[model samples]
Target: MQSVVEQFKQTYGRLNARSLGLLAELYTDDVLFQDPFRRLEGLGALTRYFAELYAHVETCSFTFEDEVVQSQQAVLLWTMSLRHPRLNGGQPVVVPGSTHVRFRHKIYFHRDYFDAGAMLYEHLPLIGMIVRFVKERV
Candidate 1:
């Protein structure tokens, strides 16, 4: 089980369009994946979702900082360093988040928790300033 969790982290950290085919090994056929932006059901949908996410991305990588495993579930804390053409002036931006995964033989469900503003909203031009201001106030 812990091995599965490690594989999950390593696989995702190096994930790319070409490597998307590896999803079959890390997820079940009916895997459910959700994040602040969208919810994807099934391995096929997951592939498409990732394709779109990385379309404009220049580079993206993840670093797992912490983890906790119990039974069929695991929680992993990670920071994603991403560089995209339309975000943050194409410079790398880091966003901290966590994922909760449940699996039997392979991951059947995965949920990601992160601030959308930090990953997207705060990287916009005008909206970025406003979002940053609001975040500072909070």
Candidate 2:
């Protein structure tokens, strides 16, 4: 049997609008998912969130780097390459992030850590300039 962590990586790598159904295989019915932007509870909400997210993206993919696992918890480091027509001029934006997940047969809790500015704000036109300036000054 494939470990949940490996299953998660595989499922997310191929996840898209069409592949949203795969989420059911990785997450429990009442799973809790949180990221920098929002917190979601239940698999239904998560599916809607991803649907909206993927609807606007031209392409998105993750490259898993490292993982630490113990008991029923795991932390996986990854870099996401995303392309959105409204952000970064439809070019790819690479954001480094990590996921912490707790699972039994399927993941029931998940949290993601990443720089929201790098993923969104820094990719916008006007906001991108301001964010970059602020970072440089800081």
Candidate 3:
């Protein structure tokens, strides 16, 4: 179990299109994964979701900062560096987030918490200005 968490950290930190095939090793067949904008169930759906996600992606990577593992659950703090054609004119975008994962032999549930405004809304043009203005005032 300890090894599984370590493996997940390593694999996830290096995640890319090529490493995506290895999801089966770290997640169960009926895995549940969710983030700010998407919720996916089952490994197959998760795979497809990732495929579409990286379709227009230029580069994506993660850096794991901290983790707490207990029983069958683990919480991970990470910062993601992402570059996509549609966002920020393909420049790198850094978003800090945390993941909560529960596993048996493999991870069965995973959830990520992060600011959508930082990831998307604040990256737009006109809307970005408005979003940032509101955020600063709040």
Candidate 4:
């Protein structure tokens, strides 16, 4: 029998430009997506949220850097690069990102974690300056 961790890898590893269905398949109907800017509930919400979330991105991709798994929990560490509207028109932002997945019903309950500065604002121009300034002061 496949371990829960293995199951998670199989479920999420197949993500691509057109993997929304696969993503929905891996998330429960009530899956909750928690992040710094948004907190959404249910697969419907998640799907809708992603549609907007992905709109700003012209092209995006992820590569798993590492994976730590145990029993029913798994952490998928990844490196992502995306085309940004503000950041050099698609500069690749290399940062450490992780997904904390809890498995149930062939899906995840929670899978979110990333540094906004490292992945987003920091890659932009004016926003990056402000973010860096705030970071240095506080």
Candidate 5:
């Protein structure tokens, strides 16, 4: 059995689109992914979700700084960097988050985490304004 840290260490670190595809190979057809805005099920849905995110950013990558890996459960402490031309190119929007995965032997059953606001909405111009307004008002 690959440890949680090992799975991440082997897949991430030098992340690219191809690496993303490789990681998806570890997800089952019925994978479940959760985040601030979306609770998506199945690897197909997960792939589409990730693809849409990649479309908006010039470059995207992740680095795992800390981790806690058990037999079937793993938690990764990491930061995702995205280069948004509208926000600031190459400025790197660093959002610290964790991906908690439940492993079904070699594939993932559940994999999810992260703050959407910090990673996305806060980095947009008009969108950021709306987020701030909504936060302040609500």
Candidate 6:
């Protein structure tokens, strides 16, 4: 049997607006998912969140870079290649991020770490300039 982390990676790689059903195979009913943007509890809320996200993106894909697993917990490093019509002239933006997940059979806790500025704020027109300036100054 494949480990939960492997299943997660496979499922996540195929995820999109149409593949939102796959999330149920990877997470428990009451899973907790947290990222820089928001914290979601329950599979229903997570599905809605992904639906909204995928609806806006032209394309979004992940490249798994590395992982460290111990028992029921895993830390996965990944790069997300994203394209949105409103961001970066619809060109791909690569964002490096990581996910820490805990599972028994299906994941119940998943937290993602990534720079909000790099993913969203820095891609906006006016805000992007200000964010970039602030980042440069800091």
lDDT of 5 by residue, 49-107 (tens): 77776665677778778878787787878888878776643478888888888876555
The true-versus-predicted C-alpha distance at residue 72 of model 3, in Å, is 1.2
- Model 1, span 41-104: residue lDDT tens: 9999999999888877888999899999999999999999999988999898899999999998
Q: Candidate 4's error at 20, in angstroms? A: 1.6
Ranking by lDDT: 2, 6, 1, 3, 5, 4
Ranking by TM-score: 2, 6, 1, 3, 4, 5
- What is the per-residue lDDT of model 4 for residues 1-138, given as tens digits with 9 covering 90 to 100? 766556556655554445667666567788777876688888988787776777666667667778887766778887777776777656666666888877755554675788878777877778988998999999
Across 1-138, the per-residue lDDT of candidate 3 in tens digits comes to: 457788788777777776788889899999999999899999999988888877777788888999999998999999999998767877989999999999888899999999999998888889999999999999
State every prediction's TM-score relative to the real structure. 0.93, 0.98, 0.90, 0.79, 0.78, 0.97
Which residue window of length 10 is worst by lDDT in model 4? 11-20
Shift in Å, residue 57, candidate 5: 2.5
Q: Report the candidate with higher lDDT, 3 versus 4.
A: 3
Worst 10 residues of 1 by lDDT: 1-10
Report RMSD (Å) for each prediction in the order shown. 1.5, 0.6, 1.7, 2.7, 2.8, 0.7
lDDT of the structure predicted as candidate 6: 0.94
Model 2 worst lDDT window (10 residues): 50-59
130, model 3: CA deviation in Å? Answer: 2.4
What do the candidate models score in CA lDDT, each in turn?
Answer: 0.91, 0.97, 0.88, 0.72, 0.72, 0.94
